[model samples]
Target chain A: MKYAFYPGCSLEVNAAAYDLSVKAVAKTLGLELVEVDDWNCCGATEYFSQDELTACAVIARNLALVDPACGQITAPCAACFLNLKKVDRLMSEHPDLDQKINQALAAGGLKYRPGSVQVRHLLEVIYKDVGEEGVKARVKRPLTGLRVAAYYGCQVVRPFKDFDDPEQPTTMDEILKWLGAEVVDYPVKTHCCSGHMTQISEPEAFEMIRRLLYCAQQREADVIACACPMCQLNMDAYQGRVNGFFNTNFNLPILYFTQLLGVAFGLQPRELGFGKELVAAEPVIAAKVGAA
Target chain B: MSVTVKSKRFVDEVIEETPGGHRLRDCIQCGTCGGSCPSGAEMDYTPRKMIALVNAGRREEALSANTMWSCVSCYSCTSRCPHNIPVTDIMYTLKRMAIREGRVKDNDGPALARAFTHYVDKYGRSFEMGLATRYHLLNRPFAAMKMGGMGMAMFLRGRMAFTPSKIRNIGQLQAIINKARELGGAS
Candidate 1:
């Protein structure tokens, strides 16, 4: 299966591991991902709050570039997925927005008719297209004895409920289970990671991150598997900071679901961008997948 | 402050300007939004109280409240609101209104908002390196120096680019922004 992939800005920066592991997993699964040429940012969450029209226009510009044959697009980041899916939804729902956004697109010598393409989150593609059996067939190294907490964050399922139950998504859980890792009860799985909240108020953002990590730790999760770049960055990079703020010593490693899946597929850790995270996954993987 | 005729205009304009503005009228002053909010404790006024303030023509109080910036856009309040009032969207509108009206009490939120928008406005995509530098430089100079350790770590990992990766034919992007700006709220 081929998809036009829009690996938004975070993939190039903080979430490089997610990008690397996504590509690695795609290769192992035999799924073809074609990069969306000349893609711009999805305008993230800030832009939407700043100017709805300009944000829609920014996303519309990228939607207009999808190859018709590969019109089914996948975004790895939750924020990007939401922005793209939202703009598509709103453009169709509001004729005024549709006309105005298209007007902006026309300035770029492009036009995107609303609903011309289907937007899916990367996890949705991996779960739907690859299937459990497809993943089960390729586990060279089963992740037995490894317990994981699946972190869905907010944007993937909230406000829109088709991919999974918004309140309690289980796609990532099922994927981890298929990869032979024990999935733990993650009650706070759908909670926000305070996206960019770290910048606005460090203490508030730290508290939000602490809740997710503390829950995962309480449930004895070896690592937290996530689908969004922003979620992973916050959990992984700020894990130490959260521990520092709260006077707790939690050493949980936060890995992209694809990174763990890559390990199970027997891909090398360095090749999957494993060593770059602040809270290293080396020790956790060594005890789990490496040993198995 | 007393609810004067001019303050009533505040309610009228919000109702007129926002897409979900009419939904605001449907709110029953329910505290569900405040209850569900992750950052509600930090807000000067809770989401529930903000709605009531808006309806009561307390424009300054609603806009000046830390509630607007404290909202992390988690969608928890919006998704769980019994009235289906787009509380989060309303928050967004309030934030923009705050910035537009220059009533923002806290600089961090509005500063970050402008930094992100300005970065995107220039590069067509966010430049993390540029955005962080610019935001801290302009807002918190001392904090910029402290971010050195994290910056060095990010640099070593090749996570950030010193230079921005610009989209080809960025002139088109500029034109699109200009057109969107010209069209104002409708665009």
Candidate 2:
């Protein structure tokens, strides 16, 4: 199945692995992902709090260009999926607001109608369409003994309440099970990564970050699997700061869901967006395609 | 340098009182939840201690303690809990109840909570620096030392974007917030 794609801001800078691993696996699975041409930011979580209309305008401009008949717009990053879903949802519920947003977009020669696109997180498309039955067929080498903590972060499920149950989500679990990996059940999986707040509120963000790592350590999770760019970026990048702040030692590896999927897909580890991560998964992630 | 755990009256009430009172029931007592808490060391009552007090029913002392005010609501305890207890949410509910019951007496918290309520009421969202600075100023009158330093730094760094992100229609916002207040029975 082919889908138009949107990779939000983090993919470009902070979360290169998410962008890479997504493109790599989408190609391998024959799931054609045509990135919306010259796409801009989806406004992610930042803009909704800034100005709802302006945020809608920003996301609508991207949606306005998408070929709706294709039916699905898959985002590898959970934040992107959430942002796009927000615009799509708000546009449907509030026509006047949608009209205003479309008008703003028209200045840039873009036209958008509400509900023109279905925003699916990359994991959802991989799980629902690609299914365990489908994934099992492609699993040349199963990750037989790996233990994964599926971290959904906040935006994927909260507030909008789309895709999965907000309080307890299992999109990642269903996907992980297909890959022949043992998944750990941890309640903190959906907690906020503190995202951009790390820049604004270090102490608070540090506490949140530390708490997450501490929990992962306690659960004996081999690696933290994430579906959002911000979660991947912060969980991987901010570990150093967190360790520094509290004067502790930790080597928790953060993996983008697709990176782990790439491993599960029998793709070479190097092609799976491993090196781009801040908290290197190298030591823990035995990256050989046939070696679990 | 240290404090003992408080009575379990407020604690037990807190455990039994929440919408999902059973959340407090599944505490494996693994201490991971407490170990995972960032502010656990700072608080007189770690979440584990609070849960124990609640289960034991000396919750009034737990409720009245100053520790309830220190939770940052980062969702650390709840998320990390092996039991899936909504510890942070329990903290939120407790804070609400505590305020109603006059448990906490502080300038920083009530003022901060007031700003948080204003954000929810006005825009259906939260603004970090704006609320922080506002709370700080209100708490200190003219001497909000903590807030002033942080606010001035954030403003100069162009980090605190203060143009309120107004809801599309203030009227609609008022209606929704009013409805929420009605449902929640908030005056």
Candidate 3:
């Protein structure tokens, strides 16, 4: 269960909790992660709006950096996954794009050929490689009937088609179900979290958050599970703003996919870096295990 | 409270013109798109009815419907479309057509479009606060004035960056912009 991992910018800067839980839980599940050596930014999808070739090249340069022997690269950030997957698909199709990108890489004295590695979302590693039977076997704490709302956000399933069912993704649902949690049916699960829209339209972005939080609250989802770092920040850190905007009062904690996985596998909140989160996830965990 | 999404000729030309055209005929009539749409309830035509109307060749009515501008292009509908139609693409095309033909008389979507163009034109990329400020000024003037303190507070608190990342490749982007303008029939 060894993998080449790319934690990306968000993991390092904002979503350290997600990064912590991913590392801790990967070990808990016997996953051996080899973080990519000297990786650059994914440039996110918005970089394409400014310059398409440069965006592709920025991510492709990372693709060029992966160890040729490495079969797969796992990204914890959704935007990073999309960026990596886009360049991977592009490189797979047009060798010329690969050439130009590698030519850019040659500027740094590092060159990578495209299709050198497969880009995977962290959730895939949990469900496919980790296996439900293995997760069920490790569940010292079953999240029985917690009714967690699994939000996929847009980037994970778009353009490159990751392991998640692109249109109607079920990876999170399947994993949560295996962990003995009641996976609630949510329509906006695969919808955009308006990634980086927090930068542009605060009101509109707040409304987007409001809609998701409202729906999740209405369904009484014990917590929302996310794989994207920006989504985690918005849904967790901004839930209070949305509640204030709409005059509703609820904390509505957001959990990274790995954090919940860690908890279900008997990892403690403090070890997984749970309490440090902007939105408290301990109550949800406590309620799940009846420890509260 | 009415939107002037008029001009049947404009609608037909747009639907028959782009790669996104004829997607009208592919509508499965599921309202999942509209139901999930954040601004669905505020529109003259939900994404569902907008597709139906276009498919029915009720071009003038569809064009004039108020649903053209509220989409945030989140790819929710396109991502979920069982019919495989890109609802956002269609909406994008419609918005372009509406502006070019002066079909949409409302300032909402057109204002957002103008704000986006202003962003790309100046910085070669979008700055959220810049767009938010411009969008506020254009569409919600009063909100812009009242929300200045709020925006500035966020700015000081490091929640927003005033400087947008600009590229030296603006000329190159203009070429792609030319290509899209042609594809979108904007020119």
For every model in order, the fraction of real contacts preserved is 0.59, 0.01, 0.06
What is the Å distance of residue A251 in model 3 from its true position? 2.3
Give the per-residue lDDT digits (tens) of candidate 3, residues B1-187: 9999976564466565333455656677878888867667667899999888776667677767777556655566776677777676577566655665667755455665466556654555445567667777767777577556555544443445666666564554444344434333344
Clashing pairs in 3: A64-A112, A199-B128, A200-B128, B5-B63, B5-B64
Q: Model 1, A111-134: lDDT tens per residue?
A: 998898899999999899999899
Global CA lDDT computed for model 1: 0.86
DockQ of 1: 0.60
Comparing 2 and 3 on DockQ, the stronger one: 3
Best by DockQ: 1
* DockQ of each candidate, alpha-carbon based: 0.60, 0.04, 0.09
Candidate 3 local Cα displacement, residue B21, angstroms: 12
> Mind sharing the TM-score for model 2?
0.62
lDDT string for model 3 (A38-141, tens) is: 55556554444333455565566556657667788999888788778867776676666566655555554556666668889888888899888888888888
In order, candidate lDDTs are: 0.86, 0.66, 0.70
CA shift of B160, model 2, Å? 24
TM-score of chain A of 3: 0.94
Clash statistics: count for each candidate: 0, 15, 5
List model 2 lDDT by residue over A65-156, tens digit each.
78876777988876677668867886786676666666666555567778768888887788888887777777766777788888887767
